[model samples]
Target: MRSRPVLVYDGDCAFCSSCVAFVERRIRPRCDTTPWQFADLAALGVVQQRAAYEVLWVTPDGRVRGGAQAVARLLLNAGGVWAVPGALLTLPPLRWIAHGLYRLVADHRDRMPGGTPACALPAARPPGPPGGS
Candidate 1:
């Protein structure tokens, strides 16, 4: 597999930028190489008209991961202290716990740096039944 991994982030996010920087500095040191691909959701097919999004990482195999799972997957690839925690977090009971923690962060990201309350929430569906027009 190619060593260089790709991380997709919100181009307009300051917190996301900081996280990218941390990945470039701290995370990169542990892994092979992370070639970050900053993308506007509109261009990446994650249209803002659909859902409020977070970070995504593309693995060498082209599998995509989002939120804390992405972070853990990246760390696991790095294969160090970062990997240890991620690996540990993936264990049976811990996996459930880890996903819970991830959900908390995803749910309240609006309060975090670079997160906008307006955009943090997913798009609401128009009121209607399951049937199409």
Candidate 2:
């Protein structure tokens, strides 16, 4: 049997906590779900920079999948009805669209319900001259 993966999320983000709660009450995947603040990220081989950017799904094999891909992995792991949509989101065109949408939501999470300014993405680099020179 495949070992349960760990779902790492931002403990400081209210929006993230709300979503995590929803997953707990509804989806209930056979995995360990936790806030990044409490997890030993270094031991898990999860870089803080990446964790700051997106939710991470650390598989038993220690492979990390983040953002939309992580969500898909979680859904699939939930099995039953979730498996279909999860599988679909990972396929071809849908995968591309899903990723883009995930970034959009993640970048604007601060404006979402239960979210705060702290949930916003780090300030983006200002545009500069061609080739940054």
Cα RMSD of predicted structure 2: 4.3
In order, the Cα lDDT scores of the candidates are 0.58, 0.85
Per-residue alpha-carbon lDDT of model 1 for 15-92, expressed as tens digits? Answer: 556667877787773333222333444333443322235456665565666666677777787776778987877677
TM-score of 1: 0.64
lDDT score of model 2?
0.85
Candidate of highest lDDT: 2
Off by over 4 Å in 2: 124-133
**Cα lDDT, model 2, residue 94:** 94
Question: Candidate 2: worst 10 consecutive residues by lDDT?
Answer: 123-132
Each candidate: RMSD? 5.5, 4.3
Off by over 4 Å in 1: 1-3, 29-52, 114-119, 124-133
